[model samples]
Target: MTDSSNRRRLRVGGLPQVLLQWGFGGLAALVLFLMMLLTFVDVIGRYLLNAPVTGSFEIIELMVAALVFCALPLVTAREEHVTVDLFSHLLSARTEQTRAVVVGLLNAIILTAMAV
Candidate 1:
């Protein structure tokens, strides 16, 4: 296949995929925005009004967790994880792809086990 065709094929499609991608993106963005807004309000309340936003620290901690979880799927879908491709020059394209898939599956299984 041509490069364009390969690129097109690799692009995410379908309602479910699109929805999942957007859902994750939206969730992460919302969490981050809320965190920033909360921090601003907390700081203003503390410094200007002599009253801090109650539970802001706990809320921020929860938001951080939520942000990480929300971004996980998007990161995985984009294959944005760090890698050490020491054998990039030695491995064929197919071999590299197979290796990636196998590694991803193993990681998924481990994560699922941990979640369970």
Candidate 2:
């Protein structure tokens, strides 16, 4: 596909789209920063002060979950999710497009179910 077409696939319009992108992006960045800070403090406390941060593992686990959830909307908006792409060479252009549409619909249905 052309570059513009590829971009159009990820393009969202209107104010809500802008809000969703920025909100999720900001949340993910904040969570990542906090995760890094926590890890640094935990390491320093363990080695230098002989007092590791309490419940660091649980905190990290929850932060990671938050991070993923916060980032998922942006990732979906960008259509950047992981895929195998192993059959790209074998499929014709039309078949590939059809496959992509089918997969996209399936993803929408699954996500809608999860939301409900």
lDDT of 1 at 95: 92
Tens digits of per-residue lDDT for model 2, 8-36 = 65464667777777788899999999999
Question: What is the clash tally of candidate 1?
Answer: 0
Give candidate 1 misplaced runs (Cα > 4 Å).
1-12, 92-95
Compute the lDDT for candidate 2.
0.85
TM-scores vs. true structure, each candidate = 0.77, 0.78
With a 3 Å backbone cut-off (N, CA, C), the pairs that clash in candidate 2 are none
Error of 1 at 30 (Å): 0.7
Give the alpha carbon lDDT tens digit for every residue of 1-116 in model 1: 36675346346465677678788899899999999999999999999999999999999999998998888767676667788878787999999889988989987887677567
Candidate 2 lDDT score at position 62:
94
Model 1 pairs whose backbones collide: none
